[model samples]
Target chain A: MQQNEENDNPPLFKSWKGMYWLVLGALIFQIILYYAITRYFE
Target chain B: MSYIDWFVLLGTVVFITVYGIWKTRGTQNIEGYLKGNNSEKWWTICLSIMATQASAITFLSTPGQAYEDGMRFLQFYFGLPIAMVIICVTFIPIYYKLKVYTAYEFLESRFDLKTRSLAAFLFLVQRGLAAGITIYAPAIILSTILGWNINLTNICVGALVIAYTVSGGTKAVSATQKQQMAVMMGGMIIAGIVVVHMLPAQVSFGDAVQVAGEMGKLNLVNFDFSWTDRYNVWSGVTAGLFLFMSYFGTDQSQVARYLSGKSISEIRTGLLFNGLLKIPMQFIILFIGVMVFVFYQFVQPPLYFNKVETDKLANTEQAAQFRELEVKHQQNFQAKSEQVQVMVNALQAGNDTNVETARQSLNSIQEEGKSIRKEVKDLLKKANPNTEARDTDYVFISFVMQYMPVGLIGLLMAVIICAAMSSTSSELNALASTSLIDIYRRSVKKEASEKHYLNMSRLLTFAWGVLAIFFATLASRMENLIQAVNILGSIFYGTILGIFVVAFYFKYVKSNAVFWAAVLAELIVIATYVQTDIGFLWLNPIGCLLVIFFGFMFQVLFGRKLEPVEIGIEKPLKSGK
Candidate 1:
């Protein structure tokens, strides 16, 4: 019952899980960018 | 340091302290003192969490780390976002639903009293020592560079943190962190700009970055998986994940930061904010170091960045040899400067072959300079074995003193001091909370009134502050301040993390089995640290896995009746009793 109430209705994302996924995606994006920076500079 | 620098440093630090005390003036009860009356919004929690994690060492030593070792250290945080997600999903709701003050209070409901006590004991020990490092790290460095007495600096830093922390407790810590985080990041950004601007007029910021990249300072990620390598992608994502989970999930200093949130959603948002911003913030600071590295390419840097030790060497019989090495160092610097210029020109001309050639030449020059520096270190060590010959901690401060404008120098110094105060205040506040909640109030004086407990909290905060100051006075040089703290945390974090993981998941594993398993796992983890070549990050996962593995084995071996406890997500208060 408490869990149901605490399910955050994020303003941008539809669900809390979606926000987590977005954060994970952002991390991946950063990693890919860093990789590109490394390869381009190397 | 000039008068402007002094005024900026003192003014910024004094204002923050007074503001923290004034803003959190009233706390008549234990709950208000320990948990800030649950009045914090997401932003305060976010900044408080960030400030707690980033110590003065982060400011003083990280740029120096980038200067010496490059930005690969950024990989250390790769697992943090995932850890934040895990904590938000698993840890936060449980803590909030339980309405627990310290994270250990949840352990008691899930397991038993001994289990909770053991976890709390581990936290107090590790964090107590860490509090010392947080205070000592910047105090020693600031004093050495600015010609202040180290003892006095430690007291001053410790005293300021104690003032607001003892007065306002968690509210004070959270209130001041908002401003400290502002000054810290703002100062760092300003320093970054000034570093790039200090570069020769011909070198654009892009050219400076290209130079740093060519010299291999921009190696941010390595996909190569090695068990022994500390900052590779695999260890970072795997071991780093476990470490961050333990730090955010179990460490009271961190737990207390978010536990003050007005709601579970606020805590989640605050943590996710940290997860997203922390990496970019680290990247910026490291890039500042990279820029500092590039700045030194055109302008000659000392053979040894630690001038005190080098100056002492000048007075020794090794003075002649040091002078000879200095000449060689000067010549190497000239060659490296020319090669760097060639690399810059090649980069500007868009000639890949010349760029590669010049980059290789510059790398060789750097290698030669390193050899000379190593010899200088050897000579310094021979002159006095007690000397801290490692100068990486001094690099950034040396740059600030030598090159930065006067007012900015003070502001940067204020940045370091504020970082120290912010982190130390949180640690002291957490220490006092855990001591009072987990130990003193729970065990020693269980029937104390609300007013009595509040007074005890204030007393414990002051006691911990003094203990930290005492440890700071006795502390010596570490190889790198940031890594030293992390290594210390990793040593104990894994074991604590394991206990929490078992409590949250393994319902059949009773308190006795987990209690003993944690003890054995902690011993084995310590043994592994003392005996093996395993990277410190791996210790987190290792200790965690050891406990889970041992927990199941011990439970079956002991033939304890498997009374499955209800580990459901019902309102924790209703579920626990």
Candidate 2:
């Protein structure tokens, strides 16, 4: 029953590093988008 | 409230509670009770983590914060994803490998019994007080807005949560949160749509955002760095990372959420899920508040959002002065409301010049409105020194009670109530687990039957519930309920995080060094909090760094006399058995 990458093999990514980057990348994207909104609105 | 409203509120809450109880009915033995028998899926863990973090104060005070302070508060969560990444990378595997029941359990293995106990005690002190606030914040607000008894409201909320949390423990808390999160998101979405719909017929959703921006309500990010400023991009990323790392990394309320996951991937996936969605969640909530700001551009909001204080003020001799200010606020609103339309029409026509001219007019009136509000607050204090005059926290709830349609009111109430219950259950569960795993079993009772320990866990959970109720009773005035929680967390979280940081990375710094380091670091954090104007977020990093620094310093002085320690070492769980 314990089939899901016990050694930290992520479902989609080759490694957990990919998942971490994806999240950090999303954070960066959000900040850039939010900054754009701030610039555009203000 | 109407009959239908009351029915909807009670029915929704009751069904969720019953479903949680029925679903997690047979939680027998200490392992199932504390760790949900390690059977939780990733999605359930995700929502449970968010639910535990949200609390009643989040639902009650966040929108109000946005209404008064704009979306700059979104920056407060900027460090969350980063923290999630760190926890996954460094904290999760060690925890799973160790098979620990609480975060502090890892501390004992890495350092010693004293260090672990010290961390547990800090968590208990902070999470205990937080449990009380989670119950009290919404109940107090609900009672104030609806003319109900505050103490009765607190007891009822506490009792409702205890009813389910005591029966099933961690499993019940997690199982019920899925339903609670659904209600929370669904109701908030409806409220957002309704706010936009309630805007003037001529004003489009796009137009409202434009208006909010022109009025300085869309302040989503501030790049400026200041030690004193609470929320901005710099603080959010740096100081916010430390705060969140401490929270999700060290605090058992959150740690317990992920620790229940069946596998390392489940915990990591669920936590990353939180990172992915949390900002958007906060953004949506804050955006709704901004839309309410836009809605009020067309509709006249109360001069003071707290109706009770205003009504009480009217009965006093200063009624004439208050009445004069109300008239001034109304006239000011009247001018701004019309000017808003002119600006909106100017935007439609693509006339930047006309928009700028009208924006100037709106800004001037808004400034006048601020001074008028300040005068009213000053006069309120002059009328009765005992009255709390911070009305911003009441803005969103008052708007909801005054304007949101009947059934929606009930659903929204369920959202706040569910938030309160969901978080309080987590705190109570975590408090009980920490008490049982760290204190009662480790120190007081050396050996016991599994059945006895199971019963003790249930009893400790119940005891914590009663203590939370007691703490709620003694709770007094604070600035904003949501920020109040964060401020309290910041004071203690840094030192806790620092101790964990030292244990994880600096093996040379053994138990005695880090324990005293944490102690010194905590004292300095409290002193800094008491003695400085530094923003609360900075305290997280300051306290954390102070611990690492002191840990190294103390280790240098004390390392020659102690046994060696190593990382990634597992400790057996002996107490819960």
Candidate 3:
């Protein structure tokens, strides 16, 4: 049976862990931008 | 609809359909037909998944949602990126190891055939109906807005989808969607820019955004928590997380997308890209709606966006009352337009006091306009009880027809139809593969050749296409079935996801416990839905967690020695091995 985990390496990140953090961090950054937009416009 | 618009719309749609069929022609092998020969790149998988999720209502209703409500709805997607990462980590490796066709195939390997069949049956029931809705929802909207026959529109869209999907299956669905996603995002971005340009010359883009903010349409982040409130941050993260997890992980339409990826890493990249892009896509659509609201503030908008009902009201006995309300609406627009200018001017000068005072006055007048609009809807309903009074769905399409240029109008129409076809094709392709691999070969015809299975796959795809069109035709007569279908999806998705969660996570829970637990959990969810006012979205988590909790209990009581389940595949998928 095939298991591709050993073959996987994401670009710009040494580990998939770093890649996932980037996604999560982007979410945080997005929420902060949205909150700022809401506050500034209000 | 000018000649150029018609040409562009027809030209773009026909081109995509033909391209899909041409690209995937002569797909005689089962692997090639069902999984695109495992040749898809990350970009194709990304676009296919995104296109499958974004139906026509997403394009039509999202902007309108922003127009009526605020961008508070963006919170609902806060959970999507997180769900993507989780799926990439937990779900992808298992499916790749199993070399499964449908997500349901993984269930059989981990548990029992009954468990796998149960999940597949639930998917067919919900997604089968949803496929029709994918076509019907937009067809009805476009038909009403463009004065075309709803049935004809349904058949055209359905037939166009069936032509390519039946011919080429998964490869066709993925190939066509690249173009579909391009048209969808391109049309929306262009529409957003155009709406900003359409605003009064004196009002800058920043000024218009502030007016929307003042008018309460830019409520992007609502940190407040409430159980009953739909779009708050609290509910979006929790309930919304379960919903997306079930959708992206278990649902075959989405699973089929990444399942076609050439490598597991490519699939992971595709999903991660989708996670990153999905929220921004929704924001653009909603921002366009807000900008349309700002544009309408300067220029007079219809008292009601749906003119069919309003026109019908004009010939009724309530015509005089309708005319009076029309005049009142005119007066309301005149006052509101002038007040908007005042607010814009105050905002520009940075005079906070004048801005606040103008905002208050503007909101009061906006309230008056809202009441007037409600009165007109009530009048329309009174005139004809069968009239569809809510016009929010019509809001964006009406703007497109009225404001967008000739060639661009055709492109926008292409965008709507492309969204419908993209999702519908995925549904058909997934349904066909599920029906073939999960049900027929496994049970009905265990020893069939690949040629026979390939033929069956194409035949099943065509059958599902016809069924979807039949349901789309049937959908026109049913009132509020869209909401019913959504509730239907939420109702079953939790239990289905629960079964898979057990298959993956609950190492101790055997088939007997997990299977029966799923049944009981579904029963409780249905009973609660019928007996209580609890929102439908909550059913997903309740159903999921209940399965886990009950599986543990049942495992302690009735659990017995496991039947050694078969991992049926004899070879590796080699999926980037």
Give the runs in model 3 whose Cα sits over 4 Å from its true position. Answer: A1-6, B561-577
**Weakest ten-residue segment in model 2 chain A by summed lDDT:** A1-10
lDDT digits (tens) for residues B1-577 of candidate 2 = 8888899899999998888889888877888899998888899999999999998778777888888889999999999999999999989988887878899888877877888888899889888988988888888889889887888988988998898899999999999999999999999999999999988888998899999999998899999888888899989989989989998999899999988887888889999999999999999999988998889888998988888888988889999999999999989999999999999999999999999999999989999998999999998999988777887768888888889999999999999999999999999999999999999999899788888999999999999999999878777454354456658888888999999898787777877788889889989998998998988879999999999999999988877755556565645554444
Kindly report, for each predicted structure in the order presented, the TM-score of its chain A compared with the true chain A.
0.74, 0.76, 0.79
Q: Candidate 1's residue-wise lDDT over B420-478, tens digit each?
A: 99999999999999998888877788776789989999999999999998877767544
- lDDT (Cα, tens digit) per residue for candidate 3, span B1-577: 9999999999999999999999999987888899988888889998999999999999999988999998988999999999999999989988887777889877776777888789998999899999999999999888888889998999899999999999998999999999999999999899888889888789999898889999999889988887678897777878899999999999999999999888888899999988898899899989999999988998788889988878887788999998999899999999988888888889889999998888898889989999998899899889878777899899999999998887889999999999999999999999998898888887788886788989999899999999999999999998788989999999998998888777777777877898999999999999989998887888999999999999888988776753333333422332211
Model 3 lDDT on a 0 to 1 scale: 0.88
RMSD in angstroms, candidate 1? 2.5
lDDT of 3 at B167: 92
Q: What is the C-alpha lDDT of each candidate?
A: 0.88, 0.88, 0.88
Give the distance in Å from residue B542's predicted Cα in candidate 3 to where it truly belongs: 1.1
Ranking of models by TM-score: 2, 3, 1
For model 1, state the Cα shift of residue B22 in Å: 0.7
Q: Fnat per model, in the order given?
A: 0.35, 0.52, 0.58
Chain B of candidate 3 achieves a TM-score of 0.96
Which window of ten consecutive residues has the lowest lDDT sum in model 1 chain B? B568-577
